[model samples]
Target: MSRTTALDPLFTAVDTAAFTDRHLANLAAGTLAAVRVPDFLGNAACRAALSALDRLPTTDYDPGRVPTPIVRFGPALNDYRDQDGHLDAERYWRDAEAARVAWHRAALRPDPIAVSMGHLSAAWGAALAPATINGRAVFGGTLREINAGALIHYDDINREYPTGLFDQEVIAQLAFNVWVAVPPTGGATTVWRHRWEPADDHHRQAYGYRSETVEHCQHVTLTPKLGDGLLFNPANFHAVEPNPDGRRIAFAFFLGLTTTGQLITWS
Candidate 1:
């Protein structure tokens, strides 16, 4: 699809005014919903970016342990090995962050048309107005070149978005992610479910949330196409399945409001 045609479905699905109203309502009720902005980047831009990415270095993954459960493949590294094979996670993350900053500066110039913040407030009202939802200070802004893969387990403890070490709350407030799908080759960024058995009878379960049977695991295959992009709640229980064929690129940011207000964070 042409760049012009790619943006049609996204604009059609979201009506700015109506979305704002619903956002306010959801904020009042304290219910979370995933908001998807499909085909965010136009076809022409996506093609150009993918071509550029092909010439760039491939992302590397860390072999050591990390706090999160998801796997990551990016140019950034969490640690590096010296001649003696020693590793330092802090230095690795710093170097990666620095490289990311430089790359972003170069990519955002000359032709800066990759991501959009159109549905930020409407889809992520609470993230935008944290003061209303919780009595605390909130911050909002954007970060560039930091790509990540995350997995949110329902049973994990101390997984607060805004306050933990990672500051998920801040991340959400920024509305950091932008997505693009390229050509006949389906890129990485697939979401999947791990094979697991049903919990014991004593384990309690909540509605809309159930354990999956080991033998009945489900996998949703997302193919990269001319007019396909997905935006959803970042805090939702999901995973960024790797791109198997071509390269699939997405951008992410954070959005925040005061404690008394609502915050809105979406893809």
Candidate 2:
């Protein structure tokens, strides 16, 4: 008798309704909400990309200093700083350049996508016209860029948990995260949480930002399989699980968008 192998979940078609109820409930409870785009990349392309990514190098560094700091983007236009406050464009540029170099070296991929000068220019224009945040004038710009050869996670030997949140808070401005999964023995990225509870002792004693308010956090597993991709809200708690098989490779792209208003284009 011939044995039949069970198919991997990665190759199965995920039910879109799987998390619909959970997503809506979270949004209503003021925790967080998310949407997913299945089959984000075609099967063949996803496989090819993952195969390429496997060959890249993975370097370690302090996540704090990476991608530049939020403060460097300049005070929120609504911040208490004076109109003529000292703005250090040079410093910001230097930091950005350093980040780019470090990112490229770690991934061993040349020509990663970046926030173009056009993006900066658009930001400057937006800054000139004060926008409101928390009922105060604010200057804010969002930019999205790609990291072709990016290591999504690293197994931290020093920590009790094998995983690390290498890309947290640092890239908050990028509201969306996209990962393309390639196949044939690729491991999935895992996202984790402490099983969020609103009534825990830890939740009750918190001040400023409270984890209690956070409904739940999740760990994502990006398994290598043709036509697999994930998109999620980054402000929420999340992490990527290490690819165990070493066959999984991915290209992650960060996306940003304005916080206010709707677009209307007439033809």
Candidate 3:
């Protein structure tokens, strides 16, 4: 992974109390903003999706082998990076059949789960009208959750571009997840006012980055309710708190924003 020295301008002058289009500009500078939209995903649709997901098969993704069921998607990713960024394709496509079926089942339904992930990515990109990538989204991510909770980390990926898109065309990627199921306790996402610049290189390793790098930075942790859709730049340092006694499930995907503002996505 590499860091870009050029910093985008942050629009601190704009009012962020509401999540308006203005946040798009702020997002370019790596700012975190959220707005509570009423019925972000129709209540009935959101509930149905959650219920349906519970019945589907899930593959464990935790390195410690916790019972966290996850289905990671994208055009084509190799293998998970080892403890030192080394490639290992051993677990590649282990449960491909089951994952694809589950994804498509919800995608083609009358009241689909937040639309096709690709469609949802495009709709959001079009709404943002990013400078380069316009409505062209890649599809793949995961129904993200953790057994107890996830460790503090940034969701940025450094994968080889076998999907035909080079990294140079994109400036940053955004993350959007619909809150369909949440716990009665902790499951908040905390976005730190920090990006993974080269200075934070020491935190890089397999099993994910450490939280100490941005410990002193300011942060805003969000606990979204059912049907709440959240959009923010995933390039910033962020983390998720634990929900030991409950489940926190979301359809998580990444939105690739090109330097010219085109929108593309993959999980």
lDDT of 3 at 244: 64
If scored against the real structure, what TM-score would every candidate get?
0.46, 0.36, 0.70
Tens digit per residue, CA lDDT, model 1, 48-133: 65556543344433324433222222322112444444434456555555545555654642232223444444454322432211
Candidate 2 residue-wise lDDT, 59-149, digit = tens = 4322443331111211211122223443243454454445445444444222212222122224334311222223432222211112222
Best by lDDT: 3
lDDT values of the candidates? 0.35, 0.31, 0.55
- List RMSD in Å for every model shown: 11.5, 14.2, 6.5
Total clashes for model 2: 19
Lowest summed lDDT across 10 adjacent residues in model 2 is found at 153-162
Task: Mark the regions of model 2 whose C-alpha exceeds 4 Å error after superposition.
Answer: 1-33, 47-224, 262-267
What local lDDT does model 2 show for residue 160? 15
lDDT of 3 by residue, 103-188 (tens): 67655243343363434444444633222113332235566655355555565544333233433365666677777677888888
